[model samples]
Target: MKKFNFLGFRFLFRVERENRDDVQVYSDTYQLKDRMVYFLVFLMIISLSSQLGNIFQRNKYIDKDIIKENIYAPRDVKYKDVLKREAIIKDIVEESEKKYIYLPEIGKKYSRGLNEFYDEILQIKEKKIKNFDYDFFEENYKLKIAPEIVDGVLDLSKREINSQRKDLMEILDKVYSHGIREGETFITTMAGKDFKDKELSNIEFKVLDIFTFPNYVYDRERTKFEIKKRVDGIEDQYTTVKAGELVLKKGELLDKEKIQVLNALGIYSFAETVLRFSVTGIYLITVSVIAYNIVTTKFKKELSNKNIYGATFLVFALLFFIFRFFGKDYLYLIPFETGFFLLQILVNSAYAFYFGIIALIYITPMINYDMVYFVITLLTILFATRFLGSVKTRVQFINLGIQLAIVKLIIYFSITFLTFGVSETVLLDSTKIILAGIFSGVLTLAIVPYLERSFNILSSFKLLELGDLSNPLLRDLSVKTPGTFYHSMMVAAVSEAAAEAIGADPIFTRVASYYHDIGKMKRPKFYVENQEGGENPHDKISPFLSALVILAHTKDGFEMAKKYKVPREIRDIMLEHHGTTFLAYFYNKAKSLDENVREDDFRYSGPKPKTKESAIIMLADSIEAAVRSIEHKTYNNIEEMIRKIIFNKLEDGQLKDADLTFKDIETIIKVFTKTIIGIHHVRIKYPGQEKESEENKTDEN
Candidate 1:
């Protein structure tokens, strides 16, 4: 140790190996290497996390050119060509061109033609019958109008009929003799009457050629329906794609049929591979950076510890793994909030909040980018930090756990009800959310003990456990040294009160006080508190030797604390209980024995009180012993004694490193005075004056 004097203040520069528990140490060489390792590990996780989003992504659409060039039927895949058959049938029906073959306009035109032909034929027949019958029969002999003619001829009919109609439709192919009407037939009713046989003269068989051909042919609509029926009857048309055949060759065009076949085979295209890789890379990089920044900066303290950072990494890995495997379907089973709460207990609330956000970033994308998980986890973390600040006892943890769980359940329920509404799925999902909330709360409680024990991390819960009376060191102190135990109890009572009055950790002070004087258990009778039968061991010892024995207790207590595995905070308090102050009684005794005795020889070897609780413990230890030896136990006397003890420690600079203010000291003095007076107050009973009181009462009567 080297002393550096600054102005009038002397500063001791201590160079020693200290316990690296809460503090961050700086080393020059490998610090950059450590940071790089963290960054590289984070990058690896980010790269792998990309594949989690790939789990549910749809395959990309292939370019027609690429599909034609690269794809093949690696294995036989068969499926139905659901649209090909129906499509072929439709094409066949549509390909057959419709034929309109409507009849020509014949209702009025053919009726007029026939009537004119009939008049002309009748005139010719009249001329032949009346005047030229001799010449017409003699020259031609083709006017074959005979009685009951069967092989009739239109040889005598005029030329130049409707030539196009006759040529195209063969309208004049109808057989008739010379002159005819609707009532006459070519054979029977031509030269005679019906069956009565009475028209042999008035209708001389030459005028039956002209007849009306109706243009009111088959109804056009009826004809169309008939033609459609005929076409529909020919429906055997088909197009087939045989199984295990080249439905779509690698270079073939991607028509509808080809596309159908490819889809049926369940083949993914090259475009999908590129797309999956791209998307995975994007999501991984983005989320990894965000997660890294948040956790590193927010949880820097906890991460300073290798075990803590390892645990945090484990949390991230577990979350990502669950998202990759189970996805958001079973989000209830994932202990997301538990990890956040654990970090809060292990570190700080600010760090835990950002750590929770990091969890959100990592898991949200991996699990389908679901806001439900993010929102629920955020709410649970907020509630945990707000309500479960520092859990001391297991019962306190349970109470807070239940409260946090209930509040988380309400938040989850409200979110689900508002988003999904009331339904069967909603009910089931809400139940899962509630279960997850409670499960995470219970998990946080269960894992805390293992974390504390395995890492030797001091927490409020550990302090509460140390405060238990059943610890081996405290138990041994009670059984091995009763007088010292009682004195320690008085110190602990006032120390706890004073620590609480000034907003320090009271339970920690009490536990530290219980074990502070554990060195006295080694030599019980040497100290005045443990002396029995009024014997004093220091009577036979020199002042220098007695001071050596008394000063050795601090060292002994430090060793016992190590053997019992006490926390650094408790061990520090045990060592610093006396501070580096000169024991005045022993120093005066040594001075009287030798004129050249130096005060440094009687001073206790100490690091001084370095914390508020330690400083209060030092004062309480001194004040408790001083009050016990006082002749008068009056309130004024006790207050005076306690104030002097505190003022003396302050004047001696023992409380230099403590974070106590003037206000805190005043509060400590008031609390210590109240506690001491309560313990050693005087009674009003008078044993000697009782007889005088009875005689005075009788005289008054």
Candidate 2:
């Protein structure tokens, strides 16, 4: 058989294999790929959703037919027509040898003259149209007309001379008279010459074509159609006209019908009144990511929850909907850090770093893009990360708030100076920034403490303080009953270190250890430290009475602690540490005397410490005291004592209620052995060392 040591090859090999088996090795490369896929899918979904939203909004405009191309009209006439008009022309022709009128020359000259006449008419008509006015129709004709085409007149005379005839004339007038007429014929004309000075000759006119001349009477019925076409045209040209000269002056509003027409035409849709703010979810995720980084650096462990993803989604959704509710005025309610900072303090600050980016995203819609909120939120997380490790009290939390406020002020003033130029009014904005900081501070002050107490978060500073043996309860023990006090301090050190090593709450272990022996305070004389002159007081009392006295201390300490306003946590440790275990000294003494004493009579009544920390403290307190009783202490002697004590407690079923494992108890034993051995380790004394001087004893006396 092989004698195995932990350092032996076989043992080391087994241990190494176990460690390898325990380690979960995952490929981060795959994780990155998964994240990339998720991000792409997310972006695709969001982009597609936004596009769908845009399509829905645009559908309203499309229903009006304003987006159709062929339904609109031109705004102005061509320069060629303007020049052709105001022309005076004449033609000369030779006559053949004949006494009567010559038909051959008349044929050419007559064609030219007729062309000149049409040209002059078109010129005059086009000139009139250059200064065309639509206000007269809107102000007066629109009211008089019945939204139906009467004659070419847009004939406002509601009592049409004959409705059919009016319709026919309106159609004919729109085709010929309203539009330019075009033809090709030779003509010689002087620019801007008087008609009287020019010979009668051919003239050319390009008649403008009025494609559709539905009158104002028909405007109401055809408005949908006409304005659809008109809007298409107007929008294409983007006409800008002064409202005063157009139809309504600044103070005057259009009649309901005209307003309807304008709406149908999408007049305001194209107005610059539609503002789009750049609110993004990515920026929010960035904040959450930053928070995660900062806090992970602080915690140095994988967070309890993958809160980076959780908080990003939460913040993104919150800000997205927040802007939707408040529109653009969400600035005054920027609690951007509230969710983020609270999450950091409660769970992990790594989660908070990412929330900084989330804050930016959530707040982007509410604040000006160039405002300091983004930088301020980031700096707040960075600065606050240092405090994350040790933040325990409300005062520390308040100080954190102050630090955050200062950061916000610095960022605000810096950004203001950068963006607002060098104006002194920036001082006012800085003041507002400072006020914002103050508000954030107040908000944190109100929230952090409640969360800590409710959630049982243990900060490092809290753990450190709890580990101190100088704490009031432990100090009371040291003064009143030194043996139990010393035992409790040793248990506290052992239990706290073990708890920390196993990733349990060290503060709970340390604090619970300090109060576990509070029950011993009642029978101080029975305890060794308070027993003077090596007197065994327990020998004088009956075993049952001594057992009763021993058992009563658990309850007595509890009542005393409560009466004195000791924290509930300490009281819990005091009540549960013994856990109804038998008063072994009295139980054995009784058994030797009577041989029939009931074991039940010797048990201590208890509620028992329910938590892991309390249970560990219970074992440590018992183990430390039992090991100290050994007269000839060796590593082997201490180990046997630890084994016996643990076995006795286990056999008595005192540990049944606790959820501790055999493995955990073995670890506890190792910690106990190491602590006891260190305390009892040998050291050489200086040669010729002497006893205390007589003067020292006289001073003590």
Candidate 3:
């Protein structure tokens, strides 16, 4: 019955170590649950942002329709055709047998002179206005004409000039009255009647009005026909009309580029494109930071250093191109799975699942869809999957991945129906995506074994394995070096008590104590344990060799731990438990034998225990061994031994680098003394064991 109860107790203990019930696993401690909760909150924020982005993208905000119209649409029309339409005016004149009206050379020269004078007048007027002189005006700005122009006009056209002489004289008189001088330059008809030189005084010429021969009115219908023909001609051929004039042809409506410019300023669909670009970019960056936060927070074994956080943030931001280029909606899910897998290996699965939900929220915005189902499914797997004892098997992790995938598919199908009415096709697509996620998750799990082996990382499983006394290395030590093994067990007990008292890590102290002196196993007889009736190996060997051998244990122990692939934290305590403190007995013995024996050679090479818990173990290991050296134990002897060892280590500067304060050392010593007294205390004899044995024999008879 006792054996059964003992076995049951052992089984229950193992279950506690292995059985990570999802809800309790994360929440079993407030710290774990809080981190998981923060992750969920982060994910939800991402989901909301993603939904908002999708809303904006669908609405087509700020879609610049003008750019499309003005910049890209005008390549079809030919410039040569536009010029052809303008040349029809010349055809109309040719058909009328009216030589296309052209001012004579002398008239043309005068006109050019008049235009030049007009331009100068306008520029001077503008300058006057800028100078704030409102009164400024040009009263008699004039261009002088030459007297020889009258004969030239007559030589050009006799009959035509004669017919239009009266009208041309009137026009020339008006021109002189405004700004022209006689005899400098003059106008003539196309037939070259020197009208300017023919004029008498300005009054006589004004009465004749030679330039105003007949107020010829072209037929309105004929003019329209002529204008249309000219337009078509200009469209068909390259023609230069007067500067800055334009011709319109059939099917030509308006300046399209100008219309497009107006449209871009929110005129045609202004809200759509602008909003999509703005919101999509926002969602992309938001999701990236959120995803980075979730993965880095979840997978990271330690809290983030600035460099790691910065690097991860940068990497997540760069992932935007992956989505834009490849159209992969589920790319972040790869990192998400990796984060969860790392969390499980480093911390616990329940927290990992929460992180997955957070990642899902982060991804929702990038994919422009809500990932609530994905988040919930991940949580469900985190809750459902058992992560304790039996979970160490690789096949179990694979099966868990498969299970999680199926759960995810179901959730996705449900979500699809809830968000956008369900269909067989949607379900099928969800399944396929879920299968991909599962494959990624399994691949992540595949790395766990290697990480555990290569990094010597101790999971909760490894810790539990170390706890079992049946472990081969431990069992052999217990048998061959019983005293040392017994000493280690007692140290573990006291160290655990001391660690708990000082608010140090109890598990770390316990584990360190268990493995601290594994080197003593190599030459058990040289040490106190397994010495039996044998002569001291030290007596036969030189004091230097004995000191060397004694000091070698700390190094030997570290190498053995390395060979066994002990985790780094544990190896630290193993190597540093003795620090570089002198093995006083060996050192003093060497000193007594030879004055030249070096003190450094007899000391254990150490980087002193740096953490509070490791330092406590170091002190505990020494006190445990030192107290046991007393043949007859007493409270005074135990107290003196504990104080002396701790004080000696401090005095020798072995504890100089350790973070143990005087207050902590005081508490640790008190706890250590109390525990030592209990372990060494003699128990009262069982009152009736002998009497009961005799009574049991008589009763059996």
Q: What order do candidates take by lDDT, descending?
A: 1, 3, 2
TM-score against native, each model = 0.58, 0.46, 0.47
lDDT of 1 by residue, 1-701 (tens): 99888899999888898565433445422343365357536645654554434335343234353333544453333234556546654666667444333334433444344444334444554465332233433243334334232112222334422332233122222322122333334454333523232232222232323233322233456646755675555433223333345555445555555666555444334555445557756766766666656555554546666666565666566656666666544655565677777776666677678767666765664554456667766776776777666665566655665566567567767876665445555465567656665676677778888877676666667777787788888889989898999998999999999988888878789988998999888888889888866879899999899999998898898898888888777888878989898889999989898999988888888889988999999999999989988996766678888889888888999998997899999999889888988888654336756578688989999
lDDT measured at residue 128 in model 3 versus the true structure, 0 to 100 = 43
Q: Tens-digit lDDT track for model 3 on 612-637?
A: 87788888888887787898675667
Scored by CA lDDT, what does every candidate get? Answer: 0.65, 0.53, 0.57
For residues 1-701, write the lDDT of model 2, one tens digit per residue.
33467655554232334332222334433343344345334433443333233223432321223332221211111111211121211111122111221123333332333333233334434454342233533453232322222123222232432343334333334332222112211221112122243232111111111122222122233435443443343211122222223422333334443333333232323221132211234543554455445534543333322333333344345544544444233342455555555666545565566545444554443332434555666676777776765766656655666666677667767765554444444454456555655555567657655544544454333445555667686677788888777777788887887787656778767776777667677779877656756888878889888888878888888887667555566777788888887777788888898998998888767776576677777777787777767886767688788878878878877777777788887887777777678777823234433234445767899
Clashing residue pairs, backbone N/CA/C < 3 A, model 1: 179-206, 179-207, 179-208, 179-209, 180-207, 180-208, 180-209
Best by lDDT: 1
Model 1: residues with Cα > 4 Å off, grouped in runs: 1-48, 51-59, 62-329, 347-354, 395-405, 422-425, 591-598, 682-701
**Residue 456 lDDT (model 2):** 45
**Which portions of model 3 miss their true places by more than 4 Å?**
1-338, 347-366, 373-445, 454-456, 465-472, 500-505, 595-598, 630-640, 661-663, 670-701
| Clash number by candidate, in order | 7, 39, 62
Q: Distance (Å) between predicted and true CA of 682, model 1?
A: 6.2
